[model samples]
Structure formats: structure tokens, C-alpha cells
Target: MNVNRRLNVSEVGDVTVVRFVDRRILDEANIQEMGQELFQLVEEQGKKQILLNFAGVEFLSSAALGKLITLDKRVKSHSGKLILSNIRPEIYEVFKITRLNTTLDIKDDEADALAAFAALQAT
Candidate 1:
């Protein structure tokens, strides 16, 4: 992984946590590429649920949002889910306005997000 890249990825149990540590998603030109990277990483690792932590992200473009939608679909196709965690109030409102929050599992915190995934996996 590129050191300067905004995303820091790791696995926690059956879930893969992709934390955005930077304020931005970095290169707009590589949004799709980055999205594919994330998808492939989870798929290759056989991770069912994913926690996309956006706590450090201050802004995200529509392109990034589109990529997230793509990722959500990919995860669901495998009978899994993508959960958005630690979304700031402002960014949460953006997702709300766009109605992505309704489609994606949007959690207020990491603990709740992980618990939700674990509970789902238990079923």
C-alpha cells in the first residue's frame, strides 16, 4: 500500500476495516482504481462484512460516493454488507441528502458497526 495514500486497511475478525486517515481520498483520477483495490482486497481475503471508517475524512466527492455504492453492491452480492462508520455530522448529512445512508449501513461509531456485523454473521 502507498504510504501517502489516505486509506489504511486492516482486518478485524471476519470484517475488514478500511479507515480513511486523511482528509481527502487523494487522487480523483484513481477513485475507480482505489475502489477496485478495496473490492479485490476484501474478496481475496474472503471477508464477508466491511467497515468503511470515514472518521478522518472531511470531504468526499461524488465519484468517491459512486465507488462506495459500487463496493456496497459487490459486498451484498456475496451475501455480506458494507457498513459506514464514524461519519462526521456534516458528511453524514451529505449521505443523508443523497439517500446513500438509507441503502448502506450507516453507524454512528465503530463499536456499533462491528457489533452489527458480528450479529449479522452469527445469523
Candidate 2:
């Protein structure tokens, strides 16, 4: 559950893109810590957009999903946007089954996600 083992992040324009490179996003207490770090980054940066690239993530837990919910709201409160990108099929299925696909913005790639965020900000 080492938070250090999971998340990786970088900036894309005004977007803070966090890539969860690990296979497991939950099943440990560190997920919460990772969530906290992401929360703080959004707050501190005044970031208007985010792209969560799940390309490397193979599995997700309810805890990780909860973190996503937290992040979604954090971005929303700032009038910012959060876009989930590169979701694998298995993980995407989980999101679909949980109906979270309705609550969050899912995209096929980084460019599409960033474009959607830009459009949201433009409005």
C-alpha cells in the first residue's frame, strides 16, 4: 500500500494529468493517501482541467472509484473539469456496471479528454 508505488503525474497545458501506472489502485490503505495527494494538487494548482489516464491500470476497487468521485467534485467546485482516459475494457466494464460512467467523463484518449475539458471551460 505504498502510495509511492502507484500514481504518476504530469502537466498538460493547464491540465494536471495523473496517470495511475500501477495495476492495483485499491486493496491497500495507500489509495487514500494517493487520493489525498491528488486532491491537494488540484486545490493548490487551481487547475482548470484534469486528465486521469488509466492506460496502465488493470484493476480498480471501490476505494479507488471513491477517490475518483472525490476528484470529480474537487474539479467541479473550481468550475474545472475531470476527464478519464484510456480506460481498459475490464476496468471500463466495472465502471459501467457501477453506473459511474454516468457520473464521470470517460474518454478514449488523452487528446479527446483534453479537448472535452477545454470545451467545458470555454462554456
Candidate number with greatest lDDT: 2
Which segments of model 2 are wrong by more than 4 Å?
1-5
lDDT of each: 0.80, 0.82
lDDT by residue for model 2 (40-89), tens: 76787576677889887878899889999999998899887788999999
- lDDT of model 1 at position 46: 62
lDDT of 1 by residue, 1-123 (tens): 334244678888878888865577656766766786677755776667789888878888888888899888888888878899998898888898999888988998889999998888788
Q: lDDT value for candidate 2?
A: 0.82
lDDT of 1 at 35: 81
